[model samples]
Target: MKKIKVMHIIGRLPVGGAENLLLTIVRNTDRNRFNLIVCCLDKEGQIAEKIRQGGIKLVCLGTTRVRHSYRKIRRLVELLRHEQIDIVHTHLYKADFWGRLVSLLYGVPVICKTEHGDVNSFKNKPFYFKAAEYLCFNKILDRLSDGIIFISEAQKKEFEGKRIKMKNSFLIHNGLDTKRFSSSNKRRSQDRSEKLSKNNIVIGVVARLSDRQKGQSCLLLAMRKIIERYPEAGLLVIGSGEDEGRLRDLSAQLGLDGSVSFLGVRDDIPELLAGMDILVQPSVSEPLGVSILEAMYSGLPVVATNVGGIPEIVRHGETGFLVPPKEPDALADSIIKLIDDPAMAREMGEKGRETVMSGFTGDIYTKTLEDLYVSLLKRKCRNRNYRYADLFEIT
Candidate 1:
């Protein structure tokens, strides 16, 4: 059987949950059965280099302006025709819109979009912007796409609550590179121990520094309260974004400058995660926290907000604690509990590691995705007029 050519389209390869997951999928995919290509609608971001280094064919259109959707569609048409892509898989908002539109127009055999974040996240925006997404993006996606993949059940429910009645939808959780983390855990444990004093307990928050969505400000408040009791406790703030300056100012204002260290856009995430005793994700809204998984794989207990797909991952008192979103006091109380009982924290961390290694590893995630792709392709082949095998034929 000839390999199915799959072209994944995304806005850019930034170091975020979606980008990381995409890279994982590509890395773990069965190359004998599938040919994977990546197309970036915007300029290549940080994660692009890793994808290229893997010897994958990557195309960057460099469509910088948001208003250049027409240009994107045109370029996509040319690329699809040139490459004879069998499947057009899209991620992120801009890619979903332009990729699907061009794929549909180009008569691509199968087109699928993965919803990385909750679409209803735009509900709080102005009426005009919300209306545009409702009519143009969501409605079109629901009607035209071959299948929609939701990373978490909570994300699927949120879309359903908004009355998105797509024909085929799937819930496939995001996965971690467990083998990498597991090995790194053993090697770094001693290093981490050597770096921290006997009295110090380090807490980590690894996510984009966007305060509005990530709620890092709330974590800062919680850290302030945490330090009042455990003065030696330190918070490691990882990842950078638009709100870094404001968050840094807030850290100083709350007298947490000494306790909070902002380490932005790290390549040594596994090493960083191993150093920490506990991980906290204080997002006002989250669609499956990947950092939490990374921490879990590194054998660290987690404390995250109980919003959007988080509860699905965190079993609240089992693997980690789930505090309500935007409540600094609740965040503090949970961290304090873990801090007070080191034994329980270690137990939880072990359980969390077990949880990820068993079900949420990159291998498991890739297998599920490959199965879905093949199943969808087979089904489409039977019913649809387009024949993928014919695309490879010479006239």
Candidate 2:
């Protein structure tokens, strides 16, 4: 009756959906049933610190900018063997490759991978370098792991079409902590009031400033149109990345200085979401967006691009408006409609909160994950016993 040791591996413990999901798993999983360990491939980011603060063991592989180091792989294998890891669950691409390979080398029984994004979208890459990286990682994913977990059914179907022979692929949507996200928190409410004065309508976007994928430029263009009409409407952007400087310049060039506020790499997401009247996710490409769920749980209506698994979350007319990716004009129109009609926005936000409470709560996500782990472990045992019987017959 010993507890199983589950190790989660990821590329980097950055402030992203994958990292947040891992953090929730570590925090919520029954400690009596499973001992959790985190293995981050690169340098630890803010989320890594949060995991450690929660009293979990975190091991960083210390991989520099270089890719595919066999020495680090061997070291990881040794760590797994010494820890007697019962299950190796990997997130993102690099971790999926190296973690599964090392787990197999260490004779770890259960290996599972979570596909947080669609691999097919790599085809849309304009640069040869990006396309090459995708091709290389796609092969690595096929070669590693026993089971695949996707954040959305859209992601699963994309993988299937690519001829990836995963025997067990399951769809488990991302979840949020509804209580933590609720607007009742005194601190969040106070902060919201301070940031957004009573009369101002705040439209916010929370994402890393990555021009290639996040489509921040498209959002800026959309904001130009929004400001042309509702000059009082303010925009608050949270999070920072490589594209911050360029995005800032673009905002100024579009004469959005006073109206647009860039609050980079914020830790106060719940407070920020609570302050917002509408949440916008203008991603050229995205998987299952946890931010959308968080906004919904915070009772904020969303306006997002109709890409990847976005349609799965945002019911076009019900929860929020879904515009085509890279369409700044369409995005502008949607935002204007919602801003003009406050009552409609409030109704949509209420419905969104209901959807999140019923389906996307963190408790439900963790329970579903636990069930999946137990089922996979049982199947592994059954397969092993059958293999033993076959060996005996041969002997």
Candidate 3:
């Protein structure tokens, strides 16, 4: 049988959960069963180059912004037609819009869109304005898409309640490469201590320094209290974004210069996670966090804000601790409690690793996706046969 050709479209192939998910799918899927190509709407990131290095074809439309790019859309349609793409799976808002539009124009058989975050989260004015152009275009994209993929049940509920006319919606949680994370054991404890210092009980957070969604300021405030109680407690923030300066200023204002280290855009995430006794994700909003799973697989206890699908992964007292969003005191208390009790922290970390090994492995994720693909293809074929029968007046 001829292999199915899938072209994945994304706004940008950055070091993010959605982008990482696309990479996992491309890398793990059976090459004999599917031919995969990546189509990025904007300039490619480091992750895109990694995809290219893996012998996968990547195409960028060179769109600087999402505003009324008809020329870019036309070029994309031409590329899809020329490449004979069978399926166009889009991620993020801009690619979801333009990718679906061009896929329809090029007569692609399968059109799928994955919702990485709750679209309703943009109902607030500031965030909506920040992403206004994409928000304006999403209605048309939602209508054009054949299947809508959600990373979590919360994401599906939020989008479905928003009255998006989705033809098919499915919840597919993000998966981690449990074996690789567990087996690598590449964490250099001495190097980590050199970076974090031996005197401090390091609490690490791996996220883009975005204030709107990531709530980094809240984490910093919590860290302020944490350091006051345990003077040796320190925070190691990884990843960089627009809010870095403000967060740094907030730390300095809190007199946490010596206690907090901002390691921007780190390449050693697994090692960083391994070095920490606890991991924190204080996101005000999140669809589902792949970082949580990665941390868990690295045997680090997690303390995350209770928001959007985090509860689904971190069972309150079992796997990790969950605290209310934007509550610095609660966040601080949870971290302190976990930090003070090494045995409890170790137990939680072990349970978290078990959860990932059992449910969140790359093999399981790829299998589930492949099964969904097969099922959708069969359904499409059945519908096509029905249409053919109706047209020909044959049974």
lDDT of 3 by residue, 141-199 (tens): 66666788888888888778876656688888888855435354434332332433344
- Per-candidate RMSD vs. true structure? 3.0, 4.7, 4.5
Candidates' C-alpha lDDT: 0.84, 0.79, 0.78
Error of 3 at 369 (Å): 1.3
Clashes of each: 0, 0, 0
| Model 2: residues with Cα > 4 Å off, grouped in runs | 64-68, 120-144, 182-199, 386-395
* C-alpha lDDT of candidate 1 relative to the true structure: 0.84
**Which window of 10 residues has the lowest lDDT sum in candidate 3?**
386-395
lDDT of 1 at 263: 92
* Prediction 3 global C-alpha lDDT: 0.78
**Considering only N, C-alpha and C atoms within 3 Å, which residue pairs clash in candidate 3?**
none
Candidate 2 lDDT, 1-395, residue by residue in tens: 56777899998977887888888788788777778999988899989888998889999988824344777877798788788777899987667667776777677878898887677554443364355465665455455556788888777787778765566788888878554554473334334333333447789898878887889889889998998888788899888888999999999999999988999887778877866888999998888788899888777779999988888889999999999999999999999888777777777877887888888788888889888887777676677763322221110
Candidate 3 regions exceeding 4 Å error are 64-68, 121-137, 164-167, 179-200, 386-395
For model 3 the local lDDT of residue 331 reads: 94
